[model samples]
Target: MTDNGPAGGMIGKVAVVTGGGGALGGATATLLAARGASVVVADWNLESAETRAKAIVAAGGTAVAVGGDVADDDAVERIFSTATEAFGGVDIFHNNAAAVHLARSDGPVADLTDEVWDGTMDIGLRGAFLCCRTVIPLMIARGGGAIVNTSSIQALIGDTWVPAYSAAKAGLLSLTRSIATQYGRQGIRCNAVCPGLIPGVRTEPDMLERILRRQPVGRSGRPEDIAEAVAFLASDAAGFITGQALVVDGGLTGHMPTYGDPVTSPLDAPAAR
Candidate 1:
């Protein structure tokens, strides 16, 4: 809720942000509102959504809250309905909801269960599909709009843990490309933001440290980092950009597997005479 200065780019535009109660989503919604967009903060937890919406309003921004399970078709419909009724129409959509808490149940193919896979895909992939399907036409009617899906670095790399989450995120990238290709002429732009280790949610300290050692930036990502990427992709500034996956993980995926390996590290080489 820090003062980020005057609002401008998003003036007169309306935005719908799923998972708005969470770290990354809340940050994105707040930024959009601060930039002058009326935002609908949707989340599975009604109270959390309302809290974010209320904060936006208190900060002199426009926002409203809607609570529902994004996995449900009816809930998705209701989310957009609230957007249309509250602000006339949506010009931006941030499809960010996902079952991150289910990571405990998600595992490699051998240990993964159908329930875990289904639950992960239900919210991460299917939910985004539903939102895009429902919003594309409305955006077409409004002349054009932007959509930024919250993907993950896991989508672009191999990971032993959270197989379902990785798969779902990968699916979002494909979905992003598909939407962009199909709707470009119609003025709708779709992109995905892939975040690295944003630790606030449920990341373990030891695991985070391990990842950080390999990260080129040598640090963990912040929710605001992803939020900034989302806002840009959803703004007029990114008009020329579409069907892209913007990685906001501080160069986590920009290095080789041996980056942190002492045996191959340049820093460990003997100094020349």
Candidate 2:
């Protein structure tokens, strides 16, 4: 809806955004379409993906919806094939599909269950791996491409309660680096966008506030913030940058922690107060 129409950037690229039903994914897909890319919005939730694609079409952008589980090899192949058949070939891939429950308290290693860990890994890490594995060869055949993986602040900092989740994200970061290094010569560029606490469709005010307090900018992230970054990375402006983790946390990780005593913390230093 926002006349983000490619204008000059990505005027003829084909982009695929996994988990296109969710807030971040939806926004990313819409933004890509706006930027002049023919987008294939893939999600496990068919209705959601369809709705998003419809909205894009209504807004005068080009997009289509595809439903599939990124964890399944067959699904991945079929989805890629379908998108390629429709759009000729893929030029950008946003491997952003993730399955995480923020409400649950799985806690540390001792208390974590195999089921929970496996599910998280299967969706977050293995799923991304499978997507890249299937897409990279096709990308090579096309002569080049750009890939942006969605990582989290959790990957860089420790989250004791979600050990498996964090570990999976960390693995994603490493995987991204490995892909960039291994295929940069082949004209494939791989990078990651590390987000802080982003307020998704399910985020409540209390949760948002708590997350904001942790950031130097004092605000939880919005989907548009991420969309803009993705546009940059997917564009020729960032053609020289690859194998990097661009943290979009509004200075969340860069800020010093504040103690109970306002005098001690940088945010609450006497002069600031």
Candidate no. 1 TM-score: 0.95
The numbered model that scores best in lDDT is: 1
Tens digit per residue, CA lDDT, model 1, 224-256: 888888988888888899999999888878977
TM-score of every candidate: 0.95, 0.92
Question: Model 2, 1-273: lDDT tens per residue?
Answer: 435444246778899999888888899999988878899999988899999999999998899999988988988887798788999888899999887653264467897888888888888999999999989988898999999999988899976557887888899999999999999999999999998878766567886776676666756688988888877887778899999999999887885566323566664555643
lDDT of each: 0.91, 0.85
Instruction: Enumerate clash totals for all models, in the order shown.
Output: 0, 1
Indicate the residue-level lDDT of 29 in model 1.
93
